[model samples]
Target: MKSISRATIGLTSSVSVLGVVLLAVLVYCCIHFWQAKQQEETANRALHAVEHLLLKPTSEYSPEDVKHGLEEVLGGQGRTQARVVDSRGNRMFGPEVFFNGEGSIREFSQVFETELPQLQAKRVELAVSTVDDERFLNFISGIFASSIVLWILVSVLISMRLIRLVLRPINRLTERIHNLGPRSLDVVLDDHKAPLELRPFIDGFNRLLGQLRENREQLKLFNSNVAHELNTPLSSLTISHELLQRRKLIEGEDLQKIVGDHLDELDRMARIIRSMLFLANANQGRKLQLQPVPSLRQLVVSVAEYLEQLAEDRDLRITVKSDATVEAETELIKRAVSNLLSNAIRYAQANTEITVHITLEAERVWIKVSNEGPTIDPLKLNRLFEPFFRAEEGRSDTGSNHGLGLAIVAAIAKLHGGDVFASSENQVTVIGFSIQTKRQSASG
Candidate 1:
């Protein structure tokens, strides 16, 4: 579909409104001018007729003859009337006229004295009425209609030209965007040459381009990591199967051990795939099966119990201090809590207590796991929740720690309308997140 520029739309609408206003003003002025012109012309005709009659020699025309001439000129038009009075204010000619009706009347009068060689000087007062405006109104309407048509034509042409001038740079910018791609991150919009109004938008688009490029690089690295992780287990399984095929006569405990080894490798691959699928779902913004849980403490206790053996193996004790209830998806919340507990068991110092502290607020609940360990670097802490980003200061068991636990926790927290946080100081580290309750979720 074809699109119109904002400048075009704005100018077109503005010009249309201005044209309407101009047309109204011009029509009113034309109507008034036409009415005034018609009245002045009629009055001048009456005055000229009186002057001509008065200038005639008294021998040539009498007062009655001049009066008759005045009647012929003014009385012919039904809307106009004329009268002549002498210097004594007595009626000399024409009928007495007065405004005695409901509608408005237009009247003009003049008084003058005339001298003749063979007659006594006589004064005359002349009056005329010329109030009918039908022809004048029709003329004004024609002129006004023509003026409006001309205005519309001129305004449309001028508006089109002005809009083109205004949108030239924007058109260039659009073309530039259309030509851009992942490989074109180095391209930059020239803000100096662009219009002042579009500078901020250009700068913002550049920032977005930079971010997109960075994400693309991260995605490439993530894919490589995933391939390598899967490749290792597949290679091990391939070697085991090959060994079994070569030694078909072999049996007993050695074969059983080989099968168990394959199972372990398969389990590792399965875990990685499951974690990736969960993260993919989270990124897609899928809605959760949110519900109210009876007790946040109970949820933590269950996760702690599931990881009790792992903590005991590391000579660590698990402790829960929660007294709040929260609303969240049952299975997803359990998964998040289990990931946090397992992460704590991996890194907490031997014989140290890993404490699960749950804090309830008016609208949300916070579940924190704190453990005494080698202080994590403040700089590295920012990336602790990034997928596959395991800190050097934390657990280093590559076989069991796939570096996705904390990432999963972060995703679950985000899905529950919350975020993850981490801090380490004084030989202690804390890692946890908050989840808004059902009330907060519903309101949001």
Candidate 2:
């Protein structure tokens, strides 16, 4: 990438060039105006000299007198010549020189009528050459050109310094980012000291760092939980294998039962692994292939039916209410509902009803499962959907429930562009999720 300093310098140079062009035009105009003013003043002086000569007595109005009078008024400069002419256009006074100057010549004439007929209709003419004015203007232009060159050089130097000053903070930020390691994830840029223009960027980057730090901590906790969960079943299987190896004296039926228990443990391990994989995919933002669910009520009903035996064990009745049509991954939705129903059945009070309520509002479908169970602590309620985070009451059932069920439900909800929520109050616990319906997705 090109340096920002270079780009800024180029821009400043362009502005400088534009300013110089405008300044040059202004100088040229001023020089031209000065030249015109000087010529006008000189012509006025010659006119005044001619008027004085006319005021003299006609007897004293000899050509020599007229010439001397004009010369005295006009300074007899070689560049400026004056002559007096009669009505017949014959030169009668002043120099007889015709201009042969190096520059353009300008002539001024004033015809006067005198009271003496002898001097009647005399024309006074002054010719001025622009050679001296041109030389002076040239000299002034040279100085201005030199000044403009110096100004450009100084401006370039100042611009470079300013660019460096402006970019110092950004360079420092880049270096700081470059030096960051996993251990330094908590470090943040100080926006307070940053330039106003860069504060927003610094603040946003600091926020991203904050998120990364949070995710890193979560990943560490997740890894530890996964190891602890898998270790239980592995330990059980290991102990069973070791017992079988040492006790060949055990009967066939006992041996088969032991093998079956091992299989169950293996199955539990498989479920945990599968749940972890699903959570990983979800966190990675894997896209879901969505299909239209004809009725949300039917879906909940089907999940309830599948877990009917589990509900029956607790003497809990499963009741589903309302319906909504939504766009979602059908199997994932079913899995999420199954997890919610199973969780409700596990915790619900015996002989109490577990209600599955579906609500449709503003193009969103909410499916809430409420069970008559012990109220969950508000503090723990928010974390109920986190992986491996089972409530105290459910921890004893870790052999069958590794606590990934609710987390899976949360992931599925997120896959459908929704979220999971939980609340426990008034001896009734409710766990639910909301999904965007087909109409909502289409509109969005």
Candidate 3:
């Protein structure tokens, strides 16, 4: 199997089509000229025979004698005939019959007068019949066939050369691609010199390369952030354990407090690890097992109930408004809702009501949590869901939340084929996610 480039295929096909057209025109012209030449030859021969019969003087030759001579000269040829008639209505030369068939005929008449005798004018007519010539047709057909074969051979040779010429740029591009390596990942094909058809593909490939580079940078930052997050608790634990070991006599209450603090730090680390693992699974395109919920409002109400105590601590009230049903993993949906509700409670002003609004449409179920809080900077709204990202700017009050709450919400939404969104305006912050539902309405 020989491989061919697009340029070669295009060039060869064009050449082949043009060659076939030219060959047809050549065949038509050759046939026309051959037929015309044959007709000309027939006409010329008839004229010459008529001239010969007219030159003879009637005094020396009688009509019968002329007729015999005419027969000997012209009758020998297969399709030629002649006739001679005098004023007395006498048949002078050959038969007085005209050719009566479906073939070409050339007629010539010559008048001559008898000399030194009756001096009467005689008219001699020559009719040459041109029947279909099989041999001539065969010869023309053979010429046409030979020309076609020759043209095909010549066209193939020319097309091969053109193919190579046309494919030179493509061969260069292939070599360039082969030489590319990891070190040249940022490099892109130069589309300016590429064929018009390949530019779109080149552009798409360049865009993919840009995305991969961005992802690589994000991964690097993520790893560094993970290390920083884990190191703080581990260092504190080491210091606390060392202090307990070195102490000769530690107070009872203080000892219990230190142990409790150690456990809390451990628990925080565990939560972070679990959240990170969940995010990893979601990014890997894992599908969650979904259970249908009859009413999303009831689900939100249940999640709100569990977080009501925390909301009250900040003097905030929790409210739920829903008109949606969900088909999702029950546990995952609860976790997502809990994260959003918890965030709202943490940030909402004291004595304000945090609203969890659910809207169910034909094709999607939307869960939005809004609260009255300090206005979040518009610039950081999109990045609020990033792991370890905090809008508080490293405030220690975040506690065991560890900045993974919103991240978990995003991951769960993605796992359910949905997305998370956040916006803030005039001290009112809203964060939500929408998931596709199995059932769709007529409008959807």
lDDT of each: 0.77, 0.83, 0.76
* Number of the top lDDT candidate: 2
lDDT of candidate 3 over 358-399, digit per residue (tens): 776567778899999899998889789888788887757634
Residue 175 alpha-carbon offset, candidate 2, angstroms: 4.0
lDDT of residue 120 for candidate 2: 49
Cα TM-score per model = 0.76, 0.81, 0.71
Q: In model 1, which regions exceed 4 Å deviation?
A: 6-147, 393-396, 438-444
**lDDT tens digits, residues 78-152, model 2?**
767777787898877666664644467788899786666555437888888887888888887888788788878
Error of 1 at 69 (Å): 12
Pairs of residues at least 3 apart in sequence or in different chains that clash in candidate 3: 84-92, 362-441
The candidates, ranked best first by lDDT, are 2, 1, 3
* lDDT of prediction 2: 0.83
Model 1 Cα shift for residue 281 (angstroms)? 1.5
Q: Which has the better lDDT: candidate 2, or candidate 3?
A: 2
Name the 10 consecutive residues with the lowest summed lDDT in model 1. 117-126
